[model samples]
Target: MNAFEEEREMMLRVQQADFVVVELTLYTDTHPEDAEALGQWREAIKEAAHVRRQYEKRYGPLSLLSVPTEQAIELGWRWNSTPWPWQR
Candidate 1:
């Protein structure tokens, strides 16, 4: 796939992972003893973090919250110049 398509697919994967984590969290809240669900939720969270970091490293931070001040300075405040997620 081309660059844009690849990026889009990565974004979709992150979104799906995040959704699964959220759903599993709610399920685990009532079924606190469900170890399997909890483990699955943790894995989903890790996957989301990994995918998000990859996306940020390639396309810039997804939001202000995702950008550390030191890293932003190191990058010369390029976030301002980069397009927003929707714009992409």
Candidate 2:
């Protein structure tokens, strides 16, 4: 695949992972006593982090919460760079 296609696919994966984490967090909030849901929520958080790291390693970062890599710095990626998430 070309660079754009690869970036889109990775971004989609990151979005999906983040969606799962958010949903699970909401579920756990109302069902805190459910051990199964709590476990799933924890796993979701880890999965989201993994997906985010994979994307950021190549595309700089999705947000400032992530520390920029040396490679990203060398590539001249900045927080205010164009094609932000909505623009993308």
Candidate 3:
């Protein structure tokens, strides 16, 4: 595939993850007895985590909705404490 096609594919995968999260949340809430659905939810969550790590490695950190991107900021704390989005 060309670059455009590759980028489109990546965007589609991202959208799929978003859709999966919504569906899994509703499914798990409504049908608590479905082990398979729960397993799917776990897989979707793992996928989201993997995607997050990939983006953080390639690009900068994606700060929380409450916080802005910290790419332009300096470290304000010790080594034990990272920026807000990355803090443990």
* Best lDDT among the predictions, by candidate number: 2
* Steric overlap count per candidate: 0, 0, 0
* lDDT tens readout by residue for model 2, 1-88: 9988888999999999999999998999999999999999999999999998888887777776775666566787666778775566
Top TM-score hit: 2
lDDT of 3 by residue, 13-78 (tens): 656786898899899999999999999999998897676555443334544431233433443223
Span of 10 residues, lowest total lDDT, candidate 2: 64-73
Sort all candidates by TM-score, best to worst.
2, 1, 3
What residue runs in model 3 are displaced by over 4 Å at the alpha carbon? 1-11, 65-88
Worst 10 residues of 1 by lDDT: 69-78
Query: What does each candidate score in C-alpha RMSD?
Result: 2.1, 1.9, 8.3
Q: How far is candidate 2 from the true structure (C-alpha RMSD, Å)?
A: 1.9
* lDDT for 53 (candidate 3): 51
Better candidate by lDDT, 2 or 3: 2
Residue 77 local lDDT, model 3 = 25
